[model samples]
Target: MTTTPERTEPSTTAGERAMLEGWLEFHRETLERKCAGLTDEQLRTASVPPSDLSLLGLVRHMAEVERGWFRRTLAGEEAPPLYYDDADRDGDFHPAEEDTWEEARATWQAEITRARELAADRSLDDLAARTSRAGESYNLRWILTHMIEEYARHNGHADLLRECVDGSTGD
Candidate 1:
């Protein structure tokens, strides 16, 4: 059986950057823990009928989010959407029959790695390379906090999804 990933507790007395990164990492591991020990089919199962949210779908969506915020916005790369476009805005939340858990996990992890690399040398106050659709630029601090918030919110969804998947639940 697959095992849950271990999460590190965020330090209370750490500096701003460390605290933010710590919480983000903790939430990331929380998602992985929620999806752990599930087969490809289990990962793809949409336990909630009205909501087509699955563990695999969440992973894919987060991958897209990471790439969008870090690669495209922060680094100003030309990366396009991996699963969605104008016609399919919710594509990431709807994994195809052929989509596997392994592939989704790999893609998500790679995006996280790339995001860290992109933000490594930049200061928290460093402005992003690109502006939002409303023409507002964000700094690294805002991006990091936003990412943490994003993961925290999604992790809550993941908690319910995991319990529905196999009767597994935890913080």
Candidate 2:
């Protein structure tokens, strides 16, 4: 029998930033755990036909999402995607392939690190410089919550994908 991957968040005594960050990190690790022990091929395995979604796709998408919100929007830097194309909006979820696990994971982790650094000193209320696609605005708090929502949604998908790939399942 295989052991379940451990995923833990800090205690409740943590501050607001720490709490938000903790939940975000928890979801991140939850997604990672779903992909744990899978091969490159397994990671690339898509769901039913007509859907290109996969574990690898989620990792890639979140990496770009993190970069877009934290680095570009929050930090006021020009940032392009690491695995997507403007001409192909869903490029993050498409063309999921093999032997790309290491690169994908590394990119995601790096984006996460940059996000933390960019958010460290800023208050949650600090507004993002980049306007939303709908021409709206957001703050660091919104970004953090958005990220949590994004991860939670994708982690649900990851749970399904992982279970389909192997019988493993957990919270």
Candidate 3:
């Protein structure tokens, strides 16, 4: 798979914004690169152990994750969770056979676009003004850091999943 181009934050006077931009860029590129090349069947295929984790599922889950962190939590939307059913938290990673590739891809693309548009205009110093999953309040700084950590954790999962799928490695 080819690595997506790195988007080093522009050298602007807005230092905080630059940092947040860089973090978002890194994670976004990481995810896009992880999904590079693979048929619809491949995207939905699980690893040898029969786990439910699939590339398509990961994309769907990450889209939901991005929405949760950057949009809902940061924007203080008080909106309900996306694709998150309390009864089955693991549902994000378990793709039904009926799930079409177009649906999954479109959902991910929409979330990514929304995140970029929202974040592009704001500085990290600009308060996101939202509460955490635990109901704790947080600023944009905390949210960006938490998102970076979340993406890193999932990239590790992507690495393993990619290796299992095609023996590919590295960004």
Candidate 4:
């Protein structure tokens, strides 16, 4: 298990970087606020009757997704994916006994840290210049906006999932 990174408050910025940074900060706060004061078991608890959504799962999945977009896609790194393989595209949330609460939180921290580092070096206008999973190219601007969309969407899910987990809600 990795160590959780230090807490980061929102920072000031300007221009397109500001926009992306603001979105990232918003989602980061939303996720943390949702995860506040929850136990490992509570984090892993499913919401609703049939849904397998859990805060832990969401955290892990977002970590993987963030790494994929920011680190791998933008930085041109070659790595096996953080999650999802042949038999388990959704294996992130369904962690085995080997995964602890600390591990889950750490995973998220690491990815978020990497993302911040990447964002610090690149502008939203920087070209992504890579093919996506569907064999289409994208610009950095598009990825930045897409990330905001992705986080906003999942954070919405996190809101309800958190509510189901502990009756907590808000920005």
lDDT of each: 0.92, 0.86, 0.73, 0.76
Give me the runs in candidate 1 sitting further than 4 Å from their true place: none
Instruction: Say which candidate scores most in lDDT.
Output: 1
Q: How do the residues 12-58 of candidate 1 rate in per-residue lDDT, one tens digit apiece?
A: 99999999999999888888888888888889999988899998999
Among all windows of 10 consecutive residues in model 2, the one with the lowest summed lDDT is 92-101
Q: Which segments of model 3 are wrong by more than 4 Å?
A: 1-14, 48-50, 126-129, 133-135
Compute the lDDT of residue 49 as modeled in candidate 3: 71
Alpha-carbon shift of residue 158 in model 1 (angstroms): 0.5
Candidate 4: tens digits of C-alpha lDDT, residues 1-171: 433333454455656667667767777767776777787788888886598888888888888888888778887767466657779988886766566668877877888888788767766667664577898776677877888788889889888998887787776
Candidate 1 positional error at 34, Å: 0.6
User: In model 3, which range of ten residues has the least summed lDDT?
Assistant: 2-11
**Top TM-score hit:** 1
Question: Tens digits of per-residue lDDT for model 2 on 1-171?
Answer: 445467797568998888899999999889888888888898898864567788998898999999998999988898877777778888888645543878889999999999999999999999998888898889999999999999999999898888888877877
Better of 3 and 4 by TM-score: 4
Which has the better lDDT: candidate 2, or candidate 4? 2
TM-score of each: 0.97, 0.90, 0.79, 0.84
TM-score quality measure for candidate 2: 0.90
- Model 1 clash tally? 0
How far does residue 71 in candidate 2 sit from its true spot (Å)? 1.0
Q: Ten consecutive residues with minimal summed lDDT in candidate 4? A: 1-10
lDDT of 1 at 97: 88
Candidates in descending lDDT order: 1, 2, 4, 3
Look at candidate 1 and tell me the lDDT of residue 87. 89
